[model samples]
Target: MAKAIMVQGTMSNAGKSLIVAGLCRIFKQDGYRVAPFKAQNMALNSFITKEGLEMGRAQVVQAEAAGIEPSVLMNPVLLKPTNDTRSQVIINGEVSGNMSAKEYYLKKRDIVPEIQKAYQKLDSLYDIIVIEGAGSPAEINLKENDIVNMHMAKLAKAPVLLAGDIDRGGVFASLAGTMMLFDDSERAMVKGILINKFRGDKTILQPGLDMLEELIHVPAIGVIPYLSVDIDDEDSLTERFEKKGAVGMIDIAVIRLPRISNFTDFNVLEYMPGVTLRYVKTVEELRQPDLIILPGTKNTMEDLLWIRQNGLEASILKHAALGTPIFGVCGGYQMLGTELSDPYGVEAGGTISGMGLLPAKTIFEKEKTRTRVKGRFHSQITGLLSELSGIELEGYEIHMGQTRPIDHQIACLAVLDEISGQQSEEYAGMCDHHIYGSYIHGIFDGEGAAQALVSALLKAKGLDCEEISSVNMRDYKEQQYDLLAKGIRENIDMDQVYQILEKGV
Candidate 1:
């Protein structure tokens, strides 16, 4: 059986996920088999497993830190919000149904059996389990049927480390208020209190920490400094979107849809030298750029309407006509087509006009298309990204629609050599002049794909390509995990953490 320790936060984006990942890395470094578990997660960013199961990306990062393969068992129940009021419920990596906020709240407890099954399976296989909680346990109005915070800790018999974000201010009040709201059972499960994202002198902060511990009767475990490491974020709440960098030698603009998912797809480009990647939400932000990318979103129709109504559609069309390269992925790919038809009412029920950048038509389906594939760009790809021709790439597909060609001018972008590791002949992506679209989420992460695109852009501007440089994404990710583990070791007391795990409630 695995010993469990839980990390709960006073609010969202309190660094709970990052801390769990750090613990996973620490346990892995100590030669113990470890895994991350989150019984329920609500996020737009998600990943597909080798088995074609969908899970939250936060768990995927922790799994990577543990030096283990990402599995659906890490996140058994995923709630992908389609709108403010509703979310698509996925259980064990498969879509169960769409339910409104109230509907899910009323029925979430019904999924407890599945959560237990997943936790038990991981317990049998690993020596330690690092669990993460969502939002706050102190939501007074939503605590009765709570299955993610206090309820989860009790279920796993996990000792909890309650963390409050001092960088957000009100750390003392938030931590004390959270503890004050916790009933006796819930308060007893918390082994320690942590002040996360501390930026200033520890000497000045020590008195407050001491006062917090004395008030809550829980030891101040550690004051974790603001982490500088780069890792995949959980959802749109990520600070990455607020980044506003002046245009570099090579400027890349990504349309920040209200429901953007997997914007991490562009994280690689941010690391390239002289490459400025910016998320543009308004027409003013969508100023002329060397490259324009329309990223994936949870709701294609609604987000497309947003761009259309907000005049970004006109700006993007102007750029497209001027021969600037435009790329789209998944939902963005669907929006680039000439028309989007939802006969099954999978999305908003209707036939809507697409951006008409690509000679393709999309039809939403009842069942999602999920698969992992290895492939290469087709020989016929032309124009700006012609440099990507025949270059190998690997990514997973997770969408609810299929695009069909509308004309001979459009050519297949890539040929899938393998599907889920089986030799097969299947095609993905399409190219029409300077416009390109694909269902593959991590298309840019392919070996040399980003470089090829950057090289072409530089050549078009007649700029010297000598300084064009980028990191190998796989190696970059490994270094980030090590940095996070090192930060935890320096700022956090791992010895006490081990004792808390061993002496679980």
Candidate 2:
């Protein structure tokens, strides 16, 4: 059995994910076999494990901070919203079915056994389990059937660290109101209250912190300063899309679709020196850039239609014709093809014309392709991108469409499955002149691939192509984890945290 502590937030995007990740890293640094657990997660951002099982990406990031392999058991239930009302429910790494809000709420209790089993599995393998809660524990209407907040804490026999987002305003009201809403037993589970995203002097906050602790009968553990760490985010609340930097030496524009998923694919590109990456939602925002990117989306057909209706499709076509390099990944890859056929009614039933950037036709299937892959760019690439040839890359594929390119278009990558050791000759991605399309989600993650593309872009623009130092994505992430742990250690009282875990509920 493993000792546990849960992190519950006052609301969504209250920094629960990062805090839990920081704690995981701290525990790992302290020489404990630590693991992260989130019984239920609602996010479009997801990852495919080595076993071809699907899980939330936030847990994957936490697992990385813990210096462990990501597992589906870390996130047992994942809800990916397809639209405003319905979400595709995944239990234990496999898709169960789509369910409406009411349907899921009524049936959520039935999945408790699965959650317990997954938690027990991690508990058995690790010394400590750091659990993360979804949204708030104060949603009175939804609290009865909740398996992710106080209910989950009781089940895990874990003391809770309730966090309030001071940055969002009314931190005192939110924390006090949340505690007021809880029953006596539920309130008893909360051992500490953490004020997150604070940006001010500690002396001024000390008065409020003392008042809050006295009001709630719980200790104020810490007030974490606003951290600006480069890491993967959970959902649409991510601030990456809002960032619009001035055009630097190298500018890259990514089309922001309505249902964008895995936009973190471009995170590494933003870290490169002399490079500016921006997500453009409107056609007017898509100014003349060195490179244009069409990112992944959840609803391929609907978002493609949105692009066409909003005039972005025409603008992208004009840019592509004028020799501006264009690249697409996953759903964006499907949109770049000559046509998209949803015969199985996966997204929207019927065949629709594509952007015609690539000589490929995509057909949506019921069964999704989810796997981790590693490969290198094909030797025979065309035009300015010939420099990208032989650049090795590794990423994962999570899509419902299969694209088949015409004879003239050349295959870009020759991939191999990481789990099955299956070698696939020219299994993924295609290129035509300056336009490129691929199903690989993390195509730009590798140092070789990103550098090659940047160099090629500079060469096309008739600029000096300097040999930049390669950045290993794995090493960069490890450095980020260490930074996160350091921040947590400096701000929070680790002795009290350890004591809470020692004397579990």
Candidate 3:
């Protein structure tokens, strides 16, 4: 191994992902080429790599911070849950198949060699590799076959920094408890402990940090404060839509349906100047928004039913009646049609009624259409976008349904010409329209599109708002990463960390 460090959380969601990202950025700033690795990641939120491989968007964000193109090697095993008991196992960007919790645990050991291979490949190219472990490393039952936490750390011969979430309270208990559960060899791999998400005074945490270090006989590496970094969330829990506080400017509401997928699409818009993204839990909340966005779902039928049960379906009709700009992507797009027919039962059994926003229908197929597409703009939505009426925009498609027009309704308003960059109007709602729907995700990645859309929503609300510069995700990620890297260097005992990475644990 070149040089490495593993960030193992005391529990899941203890800011491990952010730590890895910060380390990756810091390493890069120190003139060391760094790569982020996670042996396994389970999340519905994902990203399409430059090579057109689908991986967890968390690692992708880290990769962007490191100024590197994302690849499946960054995350060797991805478990995207289709339901509670079952998940789609993506090994190296290709779906191996669906497996139950019991089934996957039994078979995970077989894929250990593949994980090692990916790690070695990354280690070879980078001067340092920062590893992010999944969940808690102290799960005694899972420790036997654990390929993601301590087991992988041992395999990689990397030093580990155990992190605990201070914001959740029990910072001491979580760290001490996790340490107590580990065996001697696993315990030896741990270099020190770090407290994450500390709010208010650092002086207040100093006494707690001193006690933790004394008890564990490990150095307290750093105390990280709560930071509002503008980055895409890894899973449903970190979702901004689940956030409280009503939207400040535009009454932007998202239908908080079950099985929501790829919500990172709205992160940029949510962070834009004078835009408030709200998650609508009830029909009343749904009806009040200036714009309604139906997010992508893993199980379309299940979420569609959730929409109806929550009374969002009727609220959507009411909003549309008032000329609310409704937008949907992929599964959301499928829901906007007249009906969702899964005759072969790919998603669920039989058919379900859609919101009927657009005059269209969707048919679920077994063969999933997964590819990077460049969409050509067709319809005119704003004056700023008029010049872009025929511009090709890059995005991806990861859906199992095909939509067709009903009663002269268009399938996709934007037709992309990949070769010439020429765009023509094919359907009506793929890119931008008052009541729009499209199979393409991340349509806002287009230049000026995010600000334009935000500007449009603000206009609809009749509020004065300034359009900030287009959110260059790649650039913004790098900048934030640089800041984080600086933080880690100044706070962490880098000399000690480097020594551990050099020598096997």
Top of the candidates by lDDT: 1
Q: Estimate each model's TM-score.
A: 0.99, 0.98, 0.92
Q: Give a tens-digit lDDT track for model 2, residues 154-196.
A: 9999999999999999999999999999999999999999999
lDDT of 3 at 280: 73
Q: Scored by CA lDDT, what does every candidate get?
A: 0.92, 0.89, 0.78
Error of 2 at 430 (Å): 0.8
Ranking by lDDT: 1, 2, 3
Per-residue lDDT of 370-477 in model 3, one digit per residue for the tens?
666676667454332343355445677787789887766343456655412334333435432467777777777777677667766665556775545577766776
List candidate 3 segments past 4 Å from native.
Answer: 379-392, 407-411, 419-433, 461-469
**Which candidate leads the pack in TM-score?**
1
Worst 10 residues of 1 by lDDT: 464-473
Which residues of candidate 1, in runs, are more than 4 Å off? none
Worst ten in a row by lDDT for model 2: 412-421
